[model samples]
Target: MSRSAGRSARSEDSAPSDPDARSNGPRIGSDISSNFPDGGQASAGGASLDRAGAKDAPAATIASDSRSNPRNSDPRDILLDALRAALDAVGGYRSVHRRLMQEASIEGPCAAFAVGKASAFMMAGALDALGDRIEKGLVITRHGYAAEVIEPGWPVEVVESSHPLPDASSIEAGRALIDFLRRLPPRTTLLAMISGGASALVERLAAGFGAEDLARVNRYLLGSGYPIGTINRVRKRISLIKAGRLANFIASQEVLNLLISDVPGDDPKVIGSGLLIPHTAADIDTGEIDLPPWLTTMARSAPDLPPAKTMDSIRSEIIARPADARAAAAACLRKAGFDIIEHPEILQGDAVEAGSRIGRMIALAAPATVHLWVGETTVRLPPHPGRGGRCQSLALAAAREIAGKTGAYLLAAGTDGSDGPGEVAGALVDAGSIDRGQSAAPGSCPDRSLRAADAGTWLEACGDLVRTGPTGTNVMDLIIALRARSPASTERSFHAG
Candidate 1:
């Protein structure tokens, strides 16, 4: 694979020099109306919450026209508000601080290790709540996501690595994690802040496995279109640190896991491939998933790891989840006078198919209703795929379904502010998105892009891509749709223009 393949466009160089500057974070609620091809509609902004002050801050302010012309408001603005609300509910700084403060027994010298996309934010929170009690700290995060929240003279070490795929630095991080655990004195309280993307950010392979083998297996599973649960199950089988095996090295008296769930059921075992959580009987079974011959052989031949020691000193809690984000989003829309129709079931299965189904549903549904769906979607990549993630693919597919229809708009995005391998969070599609894309690249077909898994390229041409940088949280994916009120009822109903 090429160096640029599956890498985020936003490099660390693009990040602001002063980590303390609020502008260094995502541009939440920024006016980006000109980015869209369709004039008047604003592109969705990112989560605006200030990590340094989130503990005492209210929810990030969402830009809205509810007091002025609610009817003429942009669906993108409404979607942006919902996104902001979702982030507020699951914001790492607030959630981690609140959880730590509630634990009365958690005192004395502590060691902290925060890993994954939300590492910086979560680490900052831990530092705040524990203060001088935290004697040592480690932060393993995705590249370009390093935030300097650690105070001077602190013993905290930060390492940036790869994500959605593992690289050499991932291996280094894995070894460092084990060393960090081994060096801690017995009886020290260990605070483990685990979140989404931990699986790829750090790993200690089994004895027989090499970095190449790990990368190849991960690439295959990612392109296989399997759900995250299945992928994580396979991961646990191959890692020395995953599937609670990391517990083997802990010298601490108490292990506290504070997580921000990105999986379907919010299973800690599945989140980050269960770095400290054990696998159940169900987790051991791969179910009906048919593994490729190479993977099957590897699994059969892999050395068995010693069972993780069960300890009563360990405690785990899910501080934030997809449901929390969805509920918060629903509340924001409801406050804006739109009727809500939230899907009770999690959205799963193929991304393209889900988008088509949702697009048709929203186009035929009653007006003045905001339809909301939350869940992660999968994409089966071709031999060689193009630039895009599941959210972009879903958005483009939806654009095909709603072509020529008026007053219909949809937004599909990952809560992490990254969709697949790109820097942009996701995409927002209107009824005319297909035509706009085709016009931008004459003779281009949306179907071809979908088939090639190149929806990001086409979405960019259409001016439909939504970029939010790092969102400081990860729950799962969110989908929001709006159908305008009928002309006859326009005077009485609140609708996005």
Candidate 2:
């Protein structure tokens, strides 16, 4: 059979990245080598190991007697390096694509629509694996990420749009995508990549709805401190493209969807607001919950529809999730000779409360023990809130707990390379974090900034903001806590093990 005839592809694209595709890590198989477009010549550079930070030599621990590098082996630096490794392990586009190619045999021309924060890398990987067989494609991503993953002269139509909230551009992109889906030649297979931010990056509103409606709802949700599931459920109710509605337009055409799950449980029906999968009846039954008046009104007024009928034609796989990131990070931590304390419970609810709880946990741990937590946190916004996101808020709260404590530090950040309204992805808070905030604002307590939603301001002043501009993926937030270990503590841990 010819290369493009019988196969299909689709991925839930929103969560985060993928790991190395070769042996010694995770490998699909060698069959993909033969499927490469252009007779195996298309470089799968986008999915390579170098992108995962493996190429950078690991930072060496400072010797106790050395005066040249007196800064000692910072636990914060070690943890951050491990965090980067974790992101890189899963954040590559090439890795996911290569995995799919190894599992499926492509026989005919294919079209793809990749949407979310990770869209560009996902598209790059798809193109590399399938070669020019990807006849037509559309990429919708947040600003600043497309340029890095999309090679010059690449054929896909690309759109950069707003995120965390839908805008007019999001509606435009949605309409364009519907048109693109409709225009695909008969019998053409589709590969749809769905990732986080998709609900905001692309949308086709239901009747009587517009961008303003979505914007208002999203704003309310953002400020409401609702769980992601609740927020996305509302989104699915209002969107013509979400909750598997997008898949309805495909008719009988086969679809293969690969997903990166940012939502807890990695449910394909929830990622990207289930752009390609429909909700079940149980999904529609959101039990007694307090929703804003506007949302309640909308929910009651919005027509209830059955889940999309296209679930049968499309096959879905979760390529990456928080667990994958945690595992990667844990591996790095072990290599660094630290005792890792992994809390399996996902962090949730108020950011500040969560941070304080975690801070207390760290303060009680033995020195040299690293604590890690993964999951998204919600923040209830006060009126006219200041410039900061949940990560900043959490960092500031932790700062209050660790103040005056010796050798304790924490990092709270979004894996997507941004936190709140600022460029900072998150913050690293130490015992000095509180002092820094105080020194920056002499009349105020550090908690004041947290209360005002201006944690970013304080974090910036303290030189604790972590900025890495769009990591090309989105999972959730990663929190790492490190307690500096003394020689006695290290020996104890070794003995206990």
Candidate 3:
């Protein structure tokens, strides 16, 4: 259809650094701290509090909050805000533990751990209840986000790894997970915080597959623009620990899984790659797994290894999910009392198409309640020699659709703050978006040029971008509210879990 999107980048040592990175001196850095109003350094939830200053503005400023980002930011920002909100909503693991013990009936001594940008927050919520009683904890996150936790005496093990693509850190984390379980006694409680990025964080290559080769395959598939399900099929086939394999090691441990879903369906077998879901008889029979080609040859040619065993002794639950985050988002908006039209998770797919679809929908709204919910759309871009992410590209493209429409409040963001490679989580778009977008992208004429995944370029032109820095999470994406002449406009929007 679209001339083949450009070749996707790999995780090689020389792979272009984060696309959102700015060259301060000779080194590149992804620092969005200065991008937000008030320099973006307020208290945890203070980011949204700044809305008061822009209140008097016409057609909310380009840098509007998320109703505006906090799920619908962009895949990157949605991922980021979801982490922060989920973490903040449940509080940290210690606080969550206290609340659960006092509020809901927590089943047992198990703890929870997540692997993603949201790993910290997911872990934070998990530790809320299990922090003190749990024997040990393990959290693996993308490199930059490993600094959020400061738990004492809980003996939580933290590992910083790569994402979308695996690296040595992935190998280390996976092996460490296996080694850590070895030290635990039978029947010990395990609180696993497995989020979207776990596929990379916990990746242990299927024997014979090198991390480098796997990275190559990932690069190829992403550029191929295949659905995530198809990509994961190949990923699961090539990796030893993905799918349900990670859960096999803790067969002897009691597991309480706290997951933050990133995949479209949030299937346990796919979310964070079903690390805790046992490949039960049912799963094994119907999972219909897929693996990489070279990997299959390796699997067949390699020496015999014991088949992975799913532990029936452990228990797991999807404590936090994309749907949960969507609900939380819906609640926030409904509380604000705008005519709510909840779309069923329009958070996934090509950034440009998703944005255009929502933009067109917002443009056509006839002053009614329209809450659209979509999830897990992807952006397949060309190999342009430029810098940007899928969310930014979506916002840029959406800007064109809503070029002349007034009174529209549209937002798109990733649950994870880091979209492909930028810092301003997601963005806000409306009628004047093109003007702002053109201004934002001073170098590139903000003309109607889809230009394929050049979100970085488009976003830079429009000041209506929403940047929460890093909310430290991943849920997929959130596209909350877009105004279309509603008779009554409410000031608040919500999605409470």
Candidate 4:
């Protein structure tokens, strides 16, 4: 990938660097090893966060007690370092880089198509690896991502699409895709490279809910603060194809799908709405639920089929997942000598309830210095406008109870390097973050008394955002890293096991 597109620096253009009350940390130099300790699973790198009155290290920043060399044993620093490693671990570029066609390479890929924010570079790398075999490539991606592939003969079907929301372009892409599938040879081998935003890239408006209806419904959901799963559930009902019907086309041909999972849990049925795989046979009865007036009206008056059909012949391999990022991060932390407790990667439930549970768990379980969780959950939005993503919303909910306890760090970042429609993947919720937010934004910061929507705005105000410019791969998210007052330090605390 081009260095120009690399996560050069955090965008403080949205927010300026704070001047006062910042740590006196010295800037760390470059030359940090981009390689990971693992032989070769994921790509790796390092980064630092924003702080006032402190020198920013493009490599890694630590609040320097000694001005010369700054490598504090602070848990926050370790967690942040681990976070950087985790992001690096799941990169999609190295995958492309590794697949280059060397002199000894005998053959190239039969077919390939890479899409989404990271599609250009990744796809280019794939083509470079496969060389001439990368004929008839289908790249239905956003505008900027199309730059990665410039091969003259390779058919690069470019399409401008939206993310975190679907639009008319998505419908057009969907139609084009259907046409392409229909025109492809019956025996032609296909390599469909799918990633996040594909659903919006090439999408068909679900039965009754056209782009206008979808736009309106999305607007209402954001305003209402509904969970993503509920929205998807309702969505599954209206589309003719989603829920796996797209894969149904090449039922007789072979499709080796290389998917970059962007949805929570990395569910194929969720990523790009399962263009090549069906999680289950689409059943309309399961999607029925109390919906908005417009949606309810549409649901009552629409066809039951999704826009596409399910194909059984497309085989897939998930090259990236939440586990890859989580495990890599844990390895980095252990290298830094932190006692960590590994958590499951399948957490689910209502957003507020999940937040409360995580808070209580952190406050009570005083055993490990860090806790890690790597699964996706549903937010179930309501009927009001708010200002944050799932991670922010969760952070605010957890902060209501975990505030000011000291030493607790919570990172909720999506594997896709994006969270909702915003640039931020997630946020870090420390003991100081809550009170700090209250102080930073006063009544503006969301407290336990929030109306759900306020939490979004609070995250934006306090500079708690953790943004990873398109990391390439999608694999749910990780709620990893735990920092709190150590139980070993407290002699007779009730929280100590």
Candidate 5:
């Protein structure tokens, strides 16, 4: 088949059968739905424009209610609920609002630009804190983030864009951001609210490069099993706004960069591609980053790399991190009487290997023990791999390790609420998951699915997948490991939710 014909065929085959599937691009059926319900207006402090057009709308208010709080005593329910609280505590709008309110006010009118999974909430917090002091702002977030209408007098403009990969919407968002920044005066303060998905949500193409090229590069890097820092360094080298380029453009303006970190080190330079933090000469000289030949060439040849900024106008702080999330989980589990086992190092490397290793550790641990870990995992996808994400695959691999063992359970999920291309967040797996997989298809095994990177298919058949839609936050993945009561013990094991 011709290349174009092959591409068309693949696209057709991967089209979602579900009516509610997110249409960011053609991809196979996955458990997680990216088409989340729109978060209603985060703040009613100012007037605004509808995303579909520049028409007037009523100002909106941000509700403080959260979806987590469970009434059941189920261990899974408690664990998941605790996670929600953790996410809320770290990435919640109230925290950002409080922080902004406490900080010394900007001298003149300020402009805020928020980008990522938590963009709406973060932007809302800025508005509530800054009030009429913020003359105008822009928010570039994932699809479905801007579903509600804003009040007529609100000044911020919200744009929904593709995430984890750049699409047409991403291109438009990038153009909008660049245009907005270009119009600001040198003395105007710029407040950038950044989180995990900003790397893909906002972009400005280098000269002679198109969105397709950028998308292709991102896909290759995502599936390469390389760490995010490596992927972002290459990304920074190829764009006009990344690696502190945006800060360089503001020239002499005070820039306050607030972040809810989703990366391991919580380094602002890697977060949101370091939009407001310029890389120093020493940083460029530090330890090498290995990438594919094509990516290296593109990184080297890309036009308009951000020149190192010497001004001291930029300041940054991490509002949240994985440690904070893990701490919350530990506190919650301890309250429930489970002895928590915390791993010091952030989990890393391939999904299957990591999951298998962690699963074995949990299985052999003492009864009533809870193991918690946080970090991102990578999967090397096979050609046309079936629906599944790194977290799902990790859970499946862990399932295989704990097969036939009673009371062994694992909950693996992304805090952002969507994992990979699926509508579901991740999965909750136990010994029964293996039993269901075996009964669903004779001779079908988690090993086979793991090999194919098709864990979601097998997991769905086992009824082990977990879904929470979009939680309006992203801080990497969280894993909960628990062992059942000893055979002679009287205590009850954690029941799945």
Candidate 6:
């Protein structure tokens, strides 16, 4: 069967007047603009927009009857609310809309290609903003992330594929994307919506490389615990589409690249492996990257190409980033009367170590304090590692530090909603998390699980896992730690809800 068998293509004219009225396929026509009043300037601790564009009550307000008793509310609720606010502040819809609105001079007959976890939502914003101007479009997103943003009758092709690792579908999506770009008529403006996960969602390998080789390289890099920047650098060395090679197909057409940065420095060249941005000699310099023998052999064996040329016609802008999400979350917590301890620097290195340090900091923090951290962490997988991502590992490590404490909780989750190999996003662990895990499985050992990189299993056994399927955005990870006013009075059990 074809990979895109069930999804039939349709023209824009066939779209229903009220998309929400349809019961088939994913619904559309959500009023996403409502979330960003005053042209994408969000209100402080304000209402967030759901995937369907419905406004949720302000997260700060969710914790209290009015605003005086946020301390009484659940830490999980507060963290989740802050996450919502952060996501809303940097949503793909708002980012794309705001950027498109700025380029009012660019006229119709535009071709849009959105690739990443946020493709569908970004495409929705493009459809709303560009309308008939967008003559053709394509969306490439991770499996299960194309939620409610694309419908049956739309002038776009939606392809869902694997993420963090490429499969056969990824290669097929790459071919389709290349064909789409090549088929565009002359003088057509191209709008590229890029975000995290594009590196794996679509790939076109260079000559002499196959799908297995691509998977092998990705697997090695991921398990090696190399930062995303390094992994992307390796990926660009062997790809035909990445590292600005996609620009070769555009034929000098004016290109607008709007990106939602998932990298530490918000570098368009590293985000999504720089699909439309050229790589410098230093960018591909792997001498300092400490590549393994097999990877070095693979890199050396791959055919070399000429240096990538810089394009003047293409204009790129970072619409959203990790800093934006962190700021949004901090603002919400501050409005809820929590003393914020914001960490502006990016958190890196081992997940377990980071968690241990964060746990110790939370233990010593003042009452009613909320410590917020935003950055990506890495986990070095064993020969046969167990289930769990970096976030889960961090949460479990922290659980050990606060196993029997009171009035303290920590939430570690990926903003993209899915973490590692599981559907669950991350975990929310409290003082009793370790005990709950021990109670759920009497014979099981938390230490063993943590060492084996199976924190998801322990967290699940303890009912502390946080599952938010495909949050429609990718802005690295968010870690929130809360310390209550009275430790003696705040001994509460773990609540996953």
For each of the candidates, give the backbone clash count. Answer: 0, 25, 93, 35, 21, 0
What candidate 4 gets wrong by more than 4 Å, as runs, is: 1-69, 95-109, 115-122, 142-155, 182-187, 205-244, 247-253, 262-267, 278-313, 364-368, 378-384, 442-445, 484-497
Model 1 residue 218 distance off true place after TM-score fit, in angstroms = 3.8
Better of 2 and 6 by lDDT: 6
What lDDT tens digits, residue by residue, belong to model 3 across residues 1-497? 01011111112232232211211111111112321244322222111112222100000012323333433422223222322332233222222333344434345555444576667655544443333454466777887665524233334678788876777778888887777776666766666666667777776765556667656766777676666556666666555666566655664545556565666666777777676565433332213434456545644432222254345544565655566656655554444444676666446556678777777877777653345464656666566635556666676777788788776656666556566675656665667878776665555654335564556666556655555544544666666545643323321222333
What TM-score, computed on C-alpha atoms, does each candidate reach?
Answer: 0.81, 0.79, 0.73, 0.68, 0.77, 0.80
Candidate structures ordered by TM-score, highest first: 1, 6, 2, 5, 3, 4
lDDT of each: 0.73, 0.69, 0.52, 0.56, 0.68, 0.72
Local error of candidate 6 at residue 71 (angstroms) = 9.5
TM-score winner, 3 or 5? 5
lDDT of 2 at 412: 83
- Model 5 / residue 341 / CA error / Å: 1.2
Q: Which of the numbered candidates is closest to the native, going by highest lDDT?
A: 1
- lDDT of residue 395 for candidate 2: 84
Hey, what RMSD does candidate 3 come out at? 12.4
Tell me the deviation in Å of residue 488 in model 3.
9.7
Predictions: Cα RMSD each:
8.3, 8.5, 12.4, 10.4, 11.6, 8.2
lDDT of 6: 0.72
- Clash pairs, model 6 backbone: none
Give model 1's TM-score versus the native structure: 0.81
Candidate 4 lDDT over residue span 1-497, tens digit each: 22222222212442223211122222221111221112221122222222221112212222222212243345544555676666555555434434232223224335566656556545644543454565566666665444323333345566667665677776777777777777776767676677666766666654545678667766776666556566666565555456665654553356666666655556777776665665543433434456767677655453433233334456676666667778878897776545777775476665567776787777665644667877666565557755566666676677766777776667776655566655567776766667777778666646433455456567656556665544455556777647544545422332334
lDDT rank order: 1, 6, 2, 5, 4, 3
Error of 5 at 148 (Å): 3.8
What is the per-residue lDDT of model 6 for residues 391-453, given as tens digits with 9 covering 90 to 100?
999999888888777877898888877778878778888899899899999988877897888
What's model 1's lDDT at 73? 50
